[model samples]
Target: MIIAVVDGMGGGIGAQIVSSLRDELPTYIDIYALGTNSIATSAMMKSHANKGATGENAIVTSSRKANIIVAPISAVMPNSMMGEVTCKISEAISDSEALKILLPIMPENISLVGLENKPLSLLIKDTIKVIKKEFNIK
Candidate 1:
């Protein structure tokens, strides 16, 4: 399966997701790092994504072709993180037929690490569980 992890400039959350997935499900699945910039892409790629792509075009193309798309819930918002993820990107991903596994944490106006509402680690774990259950990834 092709799983695309999408993120913006500050790639803390995205990197963590890629890392966890690499450690947990290293074989069979293909992870594609889709970032809004080079920094985010590099961070995720370091976590063991098979390939990486950056910028708007890459995001759109990868997301469309992905069997599953992973991102924070904030990615669905148009003005998230000072508009780093524009409406167009969000809409394209959201509107696509691919299944989107979104984390519960929303990066509304605070840094990714600053959020005290929900533990990102748990969210990532839950997201992975859901994906595995849906795809029957034993």
Candidate 2:
């Protein structure tokens, strides 16, 4: 299956997601890193994503072909600037037929690590469970 992971900058949450997926998911699954910037793409590539692309076109194109799309719930907002994540990217992903795995915590104006209340690892585990169930991964 093709899984697309969207991120804005090259650090924090997005990088962690890429690492977790690379370490936990089977190698058979295709992981696509879709980043708003080159830095984000590089980070995910370091985590071993099968492919990496950046910017608006990359975001739209990857989301269109993915079987699953992963991002934080904050990505839904249009005004995010922490990593240059825009509303257009979020809208395209949301409009796609791909299954979405979204985290619960969304900070108003801070880095992802500063977002209080939710543990990212736990959210990732939960998301993995959903992906496994939906895709019937063993």
lDDT of 2 by residue, 1-138 (tens): 899888875546777887888777889999998888888788888888899999888898888899999887766667564747677787888898999987765666555665456588988887788988888887
**Each candidate's lDDT (Cα)?**
0.84, 0.81
Models 1 onward score TM values of: 0.89, 0.87
Clashing pairs in 1: none
Per-residue CA lDDT of candidate 1, range 39-85, in tens? 98999999999999988788888888899899987777887856788
lDDT score for residue 63 of model 1: 80
Candidate 2's C-alpha runs over 4 A off are 109-116
Q: For model 2, state the Cα shift of residue 7 in Å.
A: 0.7
lDDT of 2 at 15: 73
